[model samples]
Target: MQTLTGKTALITGAGKGLGKAVALALAAEGLHLGLIGRTQKDLEEVARQAKKANAGIEVHIKVADTGIYAQVKEAVSELVGLLGSVDVLINNAGILKVGSIVELPVEEWQQVIQVNLLGAYYVIHEVFPHMLAQKKGDVINVASTAGLKGAANMSAYGASKAALINLSESLMYEGRKSNIRVTTLNPSTVATDMTVNAKFTDGNVEKVLQPEDLAQLVVYQLKLPQRAFVKEVGLWSTNP
Candidate 1:
């Protein structure tokens, strides 16, 4: 199995939800972390938890909106300076805009696209060179199963994820020569503030997929053999 003990990972949306879970998991595995998010409090809390989980885990928190290219570029630059190399970039920052197409505000739709699609692009744009330079890395985009199909009342979110899925595939092929692995994680429904508040998943998270469950899968992919990689994987609950 590949060892991630001394590797560095940058996780967007690391303030909360699945991003936080993945950060803590990776920290436990001894990876230094660069946490990017909009909230200082949330990011700090996560950083604290990471330190508690692994005292040796180095953590750097940046307040940046992934939707903005300039912020992402600056944040990534600073993180790379601190950590030296970003061996993993987790593009997990996203938002939920649930409503009918016609009735939904245009700004809301745009916000979703900005954060969900362009956000991933911005981070990937900033981090790709490091991966290329190092000759090894992984980029994990946390998308949704909705991206694979047209769903009712999910125009902005679904479309953004769909574009992200395609982007992930394109990156996967482009980075193969440099030993970079790109993967898209399409989860049906996970217990997070985004899902629970939207009334999309069940209220009882114990019955459904949790953030830690998805984090496990992310770590599994990261631990795979160097010559092998998973292009895409979807998670679904038996009853939800």
Candidate 2:
């Protein structure tokens, strides 16, 4: 297995859910972290947890809305400067809006797309150059299974994720020449706080996939030798 020790990782939405879990997992593996989120408090808490996970690992936090191009550009540049390098990137920042076409407001629908699709694009646009210069990097884009099919009351969220999947595919092809490994992950109904609070998942959280489970998967993928990488993966709960 490859060692992640001393490498730097930039994770979006690192304040909570799968992002938070992955941050801690990577810290445990001895990777320096650059955490990005909109909430300062949330990012601070996650950074604290990551430090506790590995006292030797460096943790940098930045608050920015990924939907805004200017903010994303500044955040990525500043974090990269602080962390020295970005060997890994987790584009896990996203928002979900559940409503029919007519029921969901136009602004809300646009917001979802802005944050999920365009936001990822903005971050990748900024980070790709650094990875290219380094000639090596790993990127994991966290999509959702809802993108694979249309469903009732999931128009906005599904559309955003679908776009993300397509974007990730294109990025994978483009980055391979530079040795930048990109993986697109589609997880179904993870038992995250957002899912539970939004009532998106059934009450049986125990039967559903957890944030830490996905975090372990990220760690495993990153541990694989540079010559090999997972192109895409669809993770689902065994019983849910």
Per residue, candidate 2 scores C-alpha lDDT tens digits across 78-142 of: 99999999999999999988788999999999999999999999999999999999999999999
Cand. 1 TM to true fold: 0.98
Q: Candidate 2: where are CA atoms >4 Å away?
A: none
Clashes of each: 0, 0
> How far is 11's C-alpha from truth in model 2 (Å)?
0.4
Question: Residue 39 of model 1: what lDDT?
Answer: 100
True-structure lDDT of candidate 1: 0.94
lDDT of each: 0.94, 0.94
Which residue pairs of candidate 2 clash? Answer: none
